[model samples]
Target: MNIHVSYPSRLYSDKLSLDCGSTRICHDISVAIPDRGFTVIIGPNGCGKSTLLRGLSRLVRPSAGKVHLDGKVISDYSTREVAQRLGLLPQSAQAPEGIRVGELVSRGRFPYRRAFSTWSDEDERAVLAALQATSTLELIDREVDTLSGGQRQRVWIALALAQETPVLLLDEPTTFLDIAHQIELLNLLRNLKETGNRTLVAVLHDLNHACRYADHLIAMRDGRILFEGSPAEIITPSNIEALFGLRCVVISDPVSGTPLVVPR
Candidate 1:
């Protein structure tokens, strides 16, 4: 399915609602992910942030309303069609047993290949670039099971990057990473947005990191968005308290000048 991907990819929801089993987590909510920017969703656990991402990426179908991609209904497209336009790095993804890093990463090219097609030069370049982008080129031949926790996370991210989709959704992408690697991954995400103009969305727990790197911030609570705006506009003591029930003082981060939340 050859889908024309326009620049600054458009991905948004309209009156979107979802049900996980019998309970309704996400209500009638409408959110527009910023085109070609780093948008971060911050909330406490079980706040439906992951559900929202799943719905947006079409992993979980919305029980009502719609999720639109490039101005068309997301469900209207085939799975491969959607995979070619959007990619997702889900939380706690497990690689197949004995799968090598290169083999795992190369699987991302499935959306672009024909049935029984041989690997092309384009596939090799994409896999190399993905490994390079995640700084895992040296581990390309290593078995995924042999890698450390952080290394496995990076390899998973490489798999997502190798998909080469215009819009990418990540759920807790910094999990299992050290502070240094977390910062590195965040920087890489921002760089991906700026350099490729890719629309990047991530669900993060660190409010300070979200404020530091996100062009747009969404505060979710009880499966609903309480606030959405630029970090400076949306991240305040009042919003923090409302979102997490934790009273905190907001200060400026000296390094990035973004909002810094300090608990009182």
Candidate 2:
């Protein structure tokens, strides 16, 4: 898979600082999300990967510095404008009780419709495509609350896909998924990246999966990015030990030829 790439994209940050309530999470972090590549943020617990994702997506305003999209400050844009350009799947996403899957997914079209605007064929197509992309089309009419954890996760991803933004930010999307579903989701993300028109950024805890699927890997520790590069260039045993305090052996994955980490 030709994963490593940096073409062009609007999503980038300059010395972005973030706060979780009164506590500061990250400081002076800068990242340029590739125009058509997969960027994964990896770190130990409490290292602020999720907070960085939120900052990039504008779910939370940067405490300092700026997040820029297409050379403009992201915060300066209207909420609708932001939604049109960026889609976000937060880790704690929840659905309203009794909300059907179709209804929830349709909410992604909110930015495209006005108060009196009717649901157009374009909207329907996007929703259906998103559902199919996530393999959730069969459950389109099901209640969101009734699905299993992995199914619900897929549905949430479908909602983000329905947004149809060129830039998508996800926070631990594999959470609540079993091993098989996790691989399935990562493969789906890889398929999305094949379009060469979308920027996919995610925070993932699975080091080996990150290596396999990420075009660019960012390692964070104590609220700072320790190092970043292609997985093969950065996923060394020394880097693994520094990032997670684990002694590990790094080798090539038999399937993808990407780096694979095994703790000693």
Candidate 3:
């Protein structure tokens, strides 16, 4: 759908905190993400990066404070209504066994469909576009269970892309890939950013990849934001130490010219 949509403004959390059962994963945190850029969330393990992303996507309800999507309270939106505007690829997603790639991708059209309605021409076009965008068109007939780790990951991304949401959230998308596949996936996401007015928020484990691919970076520590800005402004030895408790040297990436970090 080529709708004339305004790029969503920065998502804001007003003193957001999350309680998973009894444990507090994220504390009172407030931050505004940019509207039309790739924003990566980084920190040491258990620093609440994924939790924060979940809160932003409204997948996990917050214990305190509120999350605002374009000034509207996120909790106020219906599930399908929210899905129409924001898509999320969680850290680990399980596809039904033996499902074909095309079928799986077509499921992304659910939010855009009326209850009990069949797929439409627009849905087919979207599924096709997503498969093409992720370079998975050739695998459409293949069973998702038979694909390699990288290919499966791409298929998952294609599903999200098929949703055609303005805001995309990914949680550690490169987790199972080798170095080359990791770079490939990051490059694909960068290309998607260039192709439209999309807002990407990814929880990334690799500090270097986050710095190189993200237009903006949010460094979290102990459930609070340690820093947020362009890579040049947020990535530094001191910032690294504060976020990950590591001493690292930050340099410029020869290819992307963004920050490149190496641990001591």
Q: After superposition, how far is residue 11 of candidate 2 from its true place, in Å?
A: 1.3
Off by over 4 Å in 1: 1-9
Worst 10 residues of 2 by lDDT: 1-10
What lDDT does model 2 reach?
A: 0.89
User: Weakest 10 consecutive residues, lDDT, candidate 3?
Assistant: 1-10
Clashing pairs in 3: none
Model 3 RMSD, rounded to 1 decimal = 4.8
TM-score of each: 0.94, 0.94, 0.94
119, model 1: CA deviation in Å? 1.0
RMSD of each: 4.6, 3.4, 4.8
Each prediction's whole-model lDDT (CA): 0.89, 0.89, 0.88
